[model samples]
Target: MALRSVKFMTRPFQHNSNRSIEIFLGTMNEGNYLNVGLGGSTQTIHPDDAKRLRDELIKLYPLALAPAAAPASKFKAGDKVTYKAIVGYGARGMDGRKGVIKDVLANEWYMVNFTGGPFDNLIKVHSDYLAAQPVEPRGFKVGDKVRRTTGQSKGVVMTVVETHPTQARGDIRVDGMTGWRMQKYFELVTDDPVEAVKAAIPTVNSGRYLVVALEGANYVPGSKPKVHVTDIGANAEAERLAKEVGGTFHVFKATFEASREKPVIPPVKTTKL
Candidate 1:
């Protein structure tokens, strides 16, 4: 006996101004079948002659396929924006204040000059922190992976959720936590935790790196892990101290000019996690 296999295909048809239909066509055991779906209803039919009907359906609902437009930024430099204070986050002490965009920085960051705020000049902030109207932090959305910037949950990674319908009133929801949270309290993290962990741990032979053993295990995941540059050298002392205190150490390559600091060395590839 020969083995039986199924072949599947799909096509979309416009039904009305606001509705569309999708048809899933398939063949099994020398027979033709169609699974038609629209909105929430789905119907299947096994017809003796499906090809002719399929072609007729395509002609009945003229294909409306077109290219989608690209998304554009809502704000630009010199644009006026306003947002409520996020308490512990940036723009603190400036509740319901208006500001002007001094400059647009890279990676969705902006420098804003708020009226009668904490700083006298422009301050750098994320795009989610500012808006056209007086609103809570709109930086986070559903399914975003983020880390808290304050309180006990600081540094702990979590995902954003829309548990409640009133999410626009500064009630950002996240997994494993209750109550309404604000978007200003959390920042997006790298999608891959392992890569983030590895990038944070500096390589031993990266040259002129600062080493400091942290007070907790798995330095990246700890709450407010603090470590000063104890020494500025790439050596085995970091590994030794990490094992001795049952904690972890990180390396940082610093660049200095006179009393001012410059850009540090970038993270290098390493076999060690």
Candidate 2:
């Protein structure tokens, strides 16, 4: 007996510009596989098997894209979505990572899922990150109060428009309504307020903060020392503190450093009398 390995013969079918269907051979042996490859590599399989696999793949593929779709109605602005990157077979890529849908974009592009370092981990994805999740309706109605999970606005639901398949879009009238046009958003809101509230919190970067100490002529021990801040999150608060204490602030370009395995010390400054 010879060792056997199943080979896949894929037939690509274009379904519009955004979607595609592929029919694959159920199984092919090495002899047939090579022969088929030599003749332009296109091989046919049992129509019934092909259709079955195609249908099964269609359903499974969507589930991989949006696991929350199982209970999509339970999704909201702040809900965390677990997105597994769909890499071509045999391609190297990250898989099973998670992100939060900060907002929804046109054509099912939900801005969700992020991964990187503390300041560098920004991952945005589409509705593909979510699968239908279970949801129960809240007593929320039009004109009810709601707050944005991200961004600078909190407001009431202006109106609710129902769409096909139990999906609906809500128009939120935020404080001052600065961007009312962009206020219409989609959420998988359920009747359960606790679940809704839990989903609305954005994913957090749970990394350690980097602290650097500087020593100089004007430096005092814990006297509101002024220091320069750098990297992605080095912001107004850091600059303000540096100015208040009259210390030199120098920002570095790196976002993260290695763990406490090695101690880093700043260069000593010498003054001649």
Candidate 3:
């Protein structure tokens, strides 16, 4: 049997956009090959880099074409967990609240339902804010009427169920509900855990960047520019795009100073105006 080989003859191509194209190894001077040029004209690749470019493309093309695997989540739906929020009604309003995992949001935060009457809003908190359910403290016993002193269930009166006031802390069941709470979070209803009211606070994101084509480039009317929100993401994207796509990168500055420059000291104009 005779040996055979497959090959693709790349045609010479010129880059049309104002952006700079990164040339790789195994690039060809002509024939359907990737090339860079200006104003829609064809240009040649760096002769020395042609072979490496071809070999790398052969290895990387399969990865690009492979089916992508679904992203994984640490916690799944229906899992009982605790998440922290900026809002709550208690002396320490930023306390952890018990929640049920509703949905796993891609590879990001978890969508949690802070299951209760007062916590109406859905919480999408990151994994860093989550913790295991806390155990009750000592000295809690059954038949005792208690009210939560901290966290989301604050002021909600709950009655102790079966007391285990021994090596393990006791548990209390919420009044009119079946869920049990740790005794450490509460005091006798007669003591009355009065909490200060606080408003909910929202979180904001930073690291946003915007990139647009240069003034003279051809563009569809009203086209939206690119936006990058990751740290150092927008700047890198903007710079790379500016090189190849011939565009201007605008970094979003979060703050600005508006003070006049200080004057250099002069020996005082003591001679009056």
Candidate 4:
């Protein structure tokens, strides 16, 4: 028999945006082998019951997006949701579309009633394909420094509002734009003034003698003000750092030897007491 193939619609092969499975018929030799394409790879199977196999794959189309061990539903009835990048069937171009979760199902699946713009019906979608409506981030608080994971966009969190019980999303002011952003889009940025100041100072060696380092009168205070010590050859780096920071440092000469010195009391001469 000549090789005959029938291409089926694309389905999610894995929980990734760039990966999918394209089901189709493959070469039918004497043994009748069919090929299933999965994430840029192919698997050959001899199906005694082709109809049954196709039915099983159809049922598993959405579940394949979630792990084998499904997680508990993070959403509940009446929760607002939006489609994630990986959508099923005709869900393409449905970004930013709003939907209401009617019911949460077993195996990380959800029954959502989508509204408006190619979404006038209910869809049984997987949890991986749905995202809760934007709310304040659960971990972020007011006055947190955040920067975008992708580009140079960064801002301080100004407002955080709770819209759902599962998680919170926050608003940030980045590049003169203020709006609620996804928590996963940004990361926290931290800085330690003390560590920064220490890094600015040069490394120096304490000569065989006593070495003392004095901070500049104009030294910028760190989170904690304290002395720092390091080894510098010939005090070269120390001198440069002192000059740059308008500070002064000195190296004293001393002798190292074993001594058993004892404190002596002075004799006091007393008159008539």
Candidate 5:
């Protein structure tokens, strides 16, 4: 009797998205006449069986196809945004995840604090994966009691010290709180309020510097009088100390002459008495 052999070929489906695809192949024997053993190498698959395998494989092609979605944007350090996962790539209940803006990284991505967890586990999402959430003000006045939304001692407003744009350092009192008795610190609040204050603050000139003026001394001619410095901080410490101890402290300007510069020479007498 002659033996029949067959070969099967399969191709994977391709999609427009940047994702991986896989293909699988299988064979079966129909004729029991040829006592086919597992190691005999005479495995045969009927033509109908091959067509059924191709159809089953095609059913899985849709699973490999990813939906068309936008790419993530380049996020910055302080941008408030939200996100939603692309279908077939995210959890069933986590279609739309909301979180506070925290950090941004290279490859056009940023982080959002969805579960209030450590930075490492925070969602590192692409720009197109997130949407900006509308920030609603917490109904607390400048002096109203409000705690830090996030940080070491979260939710303990202690006191509402001040609110400013970009940064808001609140003086929080944590004397009675458990595990936070000694944690007296400030909260750095960011967002629109702080940003507004920052914008309103005047810009200071960087080139200008502060200078201390020297004290001037009073002196009388001929008499050895104690000199007093009217202005104190302007001169050196030793000069100030000397003036305090009855020594004259003189103010020297480029064009000004010192009172002690000229010594008194008595007039010479030529006539004999």
Candidate 6:
């Protein structure tokens, strides 16, 4: 297996325009996202699209452009979203797109979904690129996951609205919607392996001894470890702790380095084998 490192992608650069694209791979979320940068503007997109675009864009020229920063918003999930970007000399070219909010991503970028049809070009976008739209309850198919926007149901796995098969869909206003909310928070997740690290133990000098509180006289379950000190005070503290926890006390003499030290258990050499 190959060791994984932080991977970054430069979205097919077109030096012809003043814009460039750069992205970083991150799992700072349950879902893997790309830290997408459009020239000075930044946002995030899915990792799969990032890889797909990377392979296709490599043949393009490198655009040496510095990324500009932008802030994410307090916008809730499932909101109607509109944004525009100078996609830089691509087939779609510079244009504005409309879609639904997917998820609240790190660094303020939101995952945008244009999953169907002509608007599907956009994946993620910064708030600066986003245009505001009114919040309204809309009709959606059953078995579709939706997010709660307000009230006690906020952020909870919501009990979605009941819709009739003939229920027409759009931004149309509906009456008597006692407990319904509009949809648009991203709810998908992707898993990645986490790296584990060991904790480092501190060292004590030669004259010191490491003290530990034992659960039993024979160390069946080592209760706790106390300070590694040279003074009798450490032994006293260990004894008191052991007693309080219904355990026993034990100590190890310090070696040239306490880290290399072992217990002072002794045996009488009355006979040699």
Highest-lDDT candidate: 1
Across 64-166, the per-residue lDDT of candidate 6 in tens digits comes to 6788765546665888776665455322532455678888787778887764454465566777667666565444545444434456654444333465444
TM-score of every model? 0.25, 0.21, 0.24, 0.24, 0.22, 0.21
- Candidate 1, residue 13: the lDDT equals 42
Model 2, residue 233: C-alpha shift (Å): 15
Weakest ten-residue segment in model 4 by summed lDDT:
156-165
- Name the regions of candidate 4 deviating beyond 4 angstroms: 1-71, 87-90, 136-273
Which candidate, 3 or 4, has the higher lDDT?
Answer: 4
| TM-score for predicted model 2 compared with the true structure | 0.21
Quality of model 4 by C-alpha lDDT: 0.63
Task: Tell me the alpha-carbon RMSD of every candidate.
Answer: 21.1, 24.1, 32.7, 27.9, 21.5, 30.0
User: Judged by lDDT relative to the true structure, which candidate is superior, 2 or 6?
Assistant: 6
lDDT of 4 by residue, 113-220 (tens): 988774387889887778889875456555565555444453333233322234434444333345556667766555788864664565455535433555665434
Worst 10 residues of 3 by lDDT: 195-204
Candidate 2: segments with Cα more than 4 A from true spot: 1-145, 151-172, 179-190, 196-204, 210-273
Local distance difference test, each candidate:
0.65, 0.46, 0.59, 0.63, 0.48, 0.54
Clashing pairs in 6: 40-68, 77-184, 77-185, 78-183, 78-184, 78-185, 102-186
Q: Candidate 1 — which residues are off by over 4 angstroms?
A: 1-78, 81-137, 150-156, 163-169, 190-273
Clash count, predicted structure 5: 14
In model 6, what lDDT does residue 203 have?
28
Off by over 4 Å in 3: 1-71, 85-94, 117-119, 134-273
Q: How much is the lDDT of residue 221 in candidate 1?
A: 28
How many residue-pair clashes does candidate 1 contain? 0
What TM-score would candidate 5 get against the native? Answer: 0.22
Locate the minimum summed-lDDT window of 10 residues in model 6: 194-203
Residue 223 CA error for candidate 2 (Å)? 9.1
Worst 10 residues of 2 by lDDT: 30-39
